[model samples]
Target: MDQDSQLLQAATDFAYYPGSHSDDSATEFLNRFPLPLIINALQTQFDVPGLESALVACLERLFKTKLGASLIPEYMPFVQVGLQADSQAVRSLACKTVSCLLENLDNSHKVAAHLIKEFNMYPLLLDCLINGNEEVAAGAIDAIKKLASCPEGIDIIFPSNKGGDTDLGIIASQCSSLGRVRVLALVVKLFSVSTSAASAICSLNLLKLLEAEIRSADDTLVTLSVFELLYELAEVEHGTEFLSKTSLFQLLSSIISNNFTDSILRSRAMMISGRLLSKESTYSFIDEQCAKSVISSIDGRLQSLDTSDRDEFETALESLGQIGLSIRGATLLLSGSSPAARHVIDAAFDQQGPERHGRQLAALHALGNISGETRSENDIILDAEAEENLLRLLYEAASKSSKLTPSGLFLSVLQQDSEIRIAEWEL
Candidate 1:
């Protein structure tokens, strides 16, 4: 190895320090190669190929230790300079280091406050977010998420009172479609931090950006990306309630209801609708009619699909399972005017051959959910006719030994209520 390679290897060894090393070993390592000296070398040796990344790996591993983490705040100037570096690699490394700094710090909030207020790093980070390569942008996203973990950081991120030059909405408007998608992703990240952050996003009407993307229907890929982010937001705590007030549900309903839209997009819309209604708490915030409309839209979409549209067919079943996770959702699916739960039943028992196995599995899962597998017997949401269908299937499974090839049906039958089990036994 050359001089630079040897130096990097040595730094890696000490930073990583395999197996159990005592405090004395760390002190010895630090005494031999002090953290500041390494930081200085990193800045001065920026031109060396592979030196930046290797040293960054060393720094990240070192920061995992208490000794290295304690010195993070002291090197804030280095981070600030690296953030502004002309080299995209250096900027990416800097973003990662900012995350490393906050992650290891005992008082992350105070240090994040310092970075936002004193160092004025948000704009630089935002620049990385908008223009950097994939790794750089990802690092910037993580750093920004850490910054938003505290109250003061939240204000800087969201900027409640006025739209600054650094406001996400302004940045999004100036960006290309791709950049706008990145901004939406960042918004989702920020929204995941706390209810207050979610409220801030709503207060700023940032979700309108997502709404606009979905409604535009100009680009299938872009709209799909927006739906993915929407699905992510739906999975966050209390996310359904937050989305309830928006026109998103109605928009998704229309997409699912429309025949000309991309089947994949309609499938995504169906899943999002299911997720939004998965929790009962969501019902408190959403209108009953809106929920019904979403379910009906999905039901209509399912009914329109022939067996050849296997992807949409399977996804619609899975979406119904998500909705059936709750009692009201199960009731809506099983007892609706069109009765979408029947699709789940037909999918479970009607299909044959290995080609249709996935469809059957999805149906089995939906039936399990609707029958309250995770809930008590009193909580099973299937109505009388639906319940009767489920029992009849169980009884048929129990009576006929020839019908157990798709073991999922037999397993699902076994997972039913004790009363149903006794009835199946008698049959």
Candidate 2:
């Protein structure tokens, strides 16, 4: 038989149900076959639908063996070229073949890198992800998932912003594979990088879509992802500023204020609310938006600290301390008869672990800030007494662990308010 016929027969040997292959003939046939000739033939088949589809099938069969696996990555570009075929049938098969090559080349990252760099497989795979063909989309998902393991590959799979539609992420979401949980997970992974990744994803204004998901999606992964991204985004000035404009602060405020059955969600809401609203600068916004509800919700949560909800309890205390930094919030803290202050002080003194200590430090800091707030006409004496209680808490914390002394000593000067006494630090 001629060389082509021999290679064809060898591929056929191992192509059926890949279990317990009893022969080395597949490996032996691939090793003797000239790699350059096979690749040229595959490329040449691009315009011939029947030949290209058959050839891709043969390549898939070949890659099931050791020798073919070793050679496929090197010639992946020729296989990739078939993706441009006019026939959708040819295109779909090409995507599947590419996935096979990617699977076989997991260890050969350089080759995978080369395939993207040379053939621009990144955009090609995204098209597949968006393809109407489920088989092709599924194939591309595997390819994208594999590529994502390489960081640069993530950017390749996730589009960079080019000033397109604002809801690009959502638009793309509609085209994503069926049962889009994996797609949502991938989006979260991309957003984890930062705003750039967020923008690179759906559009320049990806946050709008993400916020929509956070507000509307009933899925846990989707809501949690939005929360996780929001938290991470808060770490950077750009992200935090973007979030502040959105109803994020309001959403978080509501999430904590409501009696959400999900304890973890409640805990996250409290932590995030405290994080975003704690700054004195944010006080005006909170006062205008959620002053009354913030006070009432945090107060109720603190009074009902269940052991199963200890995390939420600790987070609520932290939120309480933050609330004290603002005028509207400080009003709640300054009330001498309010159990909110007492709950905060009691929770603050707990030496259970480092996390609890951190929560305690937050409470002390809030009291310290409230002390410096110019008290209103009705509660000067009461505010002063609360200040004294705060100093006592600080001293107790410092005495227990000298490590806590720094947090005790940290101070901040609010823009609208005077200097912080317990010491102010903004994270």
Candidate 3:
């Protein structure tokens, strides 16, 4: 048999192995088979219908054996096809393959750029974001997130409308309940890319579409993602003004009253409250009731902390603190049972250590926000030692990291606070 046929046959036979093979035999067989042949077969399968099932089966074997890395370069085109394929099964497998490839940062950029250039794939992906099966939508969103990580990829994926009928309005309007949910999740992931594209996405009035979802949808993922996206957008220059015009506070109030049972949804609501509270326009909404609920949530989680619950609790507290900063409400919230919250904050600070200094700086910014309302009170004073530590963290973050979100916010807040004196020290 020719080399190609032999490789194909080997792939086909490999798919049926139910258990692990002995290391020596597996190593010998892998050594005999060239990587290019595997890539050719997978790429060919992309255009041929009904071949994805076999390809998936074979790829699973290859992935299991750690032989898939060699085909990383050739898999991008197939990954694109898998993303846009009419077959849900194929699309699902394609998503898994792309996710696996993303483990290598170099491959991620190459594949992401290629996927972004596949213009025909956009509408289908958008549709998948709105109407495809759940697995398909998840996969498509995952692909989009990876692609959006690259600036060139974002430019290609989110191109400007050339003045024709390119408004996302019709698509956004027609979204079914489930579609809206998935779209919200996708938008949140997209918004998390970088500040530049995030600004562009906000300009597209994507949040308006999300506001519609927040008002009409009940899905936890959708609601949470919407809140997260809004929070990110609010951190941008123009986002606060855009958010003020919407009935965001009213919608969040409704969600709070009716859906507190859903922890995920509640968590998102708290985050939105925090983001809105960061802005002056939404400060009135953070009344006694809202503060109490947020504090209670933090207290409850802290009382019964677990590894899984720590991340969510930290997020809730971070948002709560931001809200407190926006409205000068942290003293009351931080007074009683504040130690647990402080623990969470301090843990967030220490987790980043000196190497991940940006995260430490963000923790300091969060601390600043939390302490802003009570800087005068001895009960919640910003001690000199803590201030020095925060300054050190911010300096290290600025000098070392490229441009992290947390550290950026840290620098902005530190610069705004006249109490912070740079002339006294370096960084």
Candidate 4:
């Protein structure tokens, strides 16, 4: 019999083999089906014009047989072909199969090396990263991670967004929240592995794009995902440097201003601000323009807070404390803005409030951080009543618990040392 007929007979015979058959006999019989037959079947199953389901079935059976890995060399062409499959299901299955093979780390590396030599796979994979369904995109990311250490792979995956005019801009614009989340997750994973790549990606304006989406997206999960990605990116070396750019600061201000009711987004914004301020260099670049934007955002939120908005307002106040600590330009924020401060303070002290004490405490801390004591003579405008009220609040907070003693101590320092007060409070 010819090779095809022989392979078909072997497949039929193997199906009938008893479960208790001797290992040696079973191994020998299974070995009778050559690697080429398995490779051809996988391709023919998936590559035919309208036989994607059949292809998936064939691959599933082959995967069950545990013979796919052994035929990696013969399957390489199919992988390349599958990456560009018109049907998302077929492409997704291809990615799954590749990921399954990659479970063997050594084999994964070898496949990656082979893939590097195939130039088409790199761009095709990038396209998958941008437009594929979540499963397919996730699988593509897994494959890229397996090969990320390869120079060619890194080169392919880490290009500047401006390198070539492609559809990513359009895709990013029209992408669903699920698609954006998957793409952001992949980009974040890549950043975790290589700081240089992270810096490059950041400079390419990906963060700005994500920040725009965060401002407009009403979906809590999508906002949470984007915020988490930004938080992760900020933790990288020089990550904050990118964030300190004017565009990013403006975007952040816009998001803060939008003030969606999602607690997670509020908390995430607080976390990101804290991390970005951890770098001293990043702090200096947040100039007066950025400060005005942030202050405007805070003012807008304050005006929107009613009894129903208590939870969201309190979360925003906590974020304000974080912002006060990190942003050097914070002193300029809310200056001559008594209405905004009064609104926030009123919410903080509201009876039966959602986060009454916590909100008051944070606002008090922020007020101390940005008061007029440190401002130049021309810039200073002391609000004696506000200062006295802050001190009273601190005293009350200190009475409530030993935990607030430091807040009391800081308040005393503000009262006693004019220099510390001037530096923090001066715009």
**Per-model lDDT:** 0.78, 0.56, 0.56, 0.56
Clashing pairs for model 4 are: 45-55, 373-422, 374-422, 374-426, 375-426
Return the TM-score for candidate 4, rounded to 2 decimals: 0.57
User: How many angstroms is residue 149 displaced in model 4 relative to the true structure, after the best TM-score fit?
Assistant: 4.1
Q: In candidate 2, list every pair of residues with a backbone clash.
A: 169-202, 410-423, 410-424, 411-423, 411-424, 412-424
Compose the digit string of candidate 1's lDDT tens values, residues 83-160: 888877778878877776677657567765776567878888898988888888898999999888888888777675
Best-fitting candidate, measured by lDDT? 1
Model 4 over residues 1-427: C-alpha lDDT tens digits? 7644555555555544455334354456547654455556645654344334544544534543444544554566777777787867667766666555555444656555555456356656666776787767877887766555545455666554454523334446666667667666766666666666666556666666677767776777788878888888777775655566636666666566655445556556645654564344665566756655655666676676675655566666655544444324343333452433444344333334334544545555555444433335553443555445444554554555443563554554355335435533432
Question: Candidate 3 lDDT, tens digit per residue, 94-167?
Answer: 66665555545445576646544653555555656665678778877886677677766676566765332223
lDDT for model 1: 0.78
Better-scoring candidate (TM-score), 2 or 3 = 3
Each candidate: RMSD: 5.1, 12.9, 14.3, 10.6
TM-scores for all predictions: 0.85, 0.45, 0.50, 0.57
TM-score of 2: 0.45
In angstroms, give how far residue 175 of model 2 lies from its true place: 5.7
In candidate 1, where is summed lDDT lowest over 10 consecutive residues? Answer: 418-427
Clash counts per candidate, in order, are 0, 6, 0, 5
Candidates ranked, most accurate by TM-score first: 1, 4, 3, 2
Scanning candidate 3 in windows of ten residues, the lowest lDDT window is: 418-427
Flag the better candidate by TM-score, 2 or 4. 4
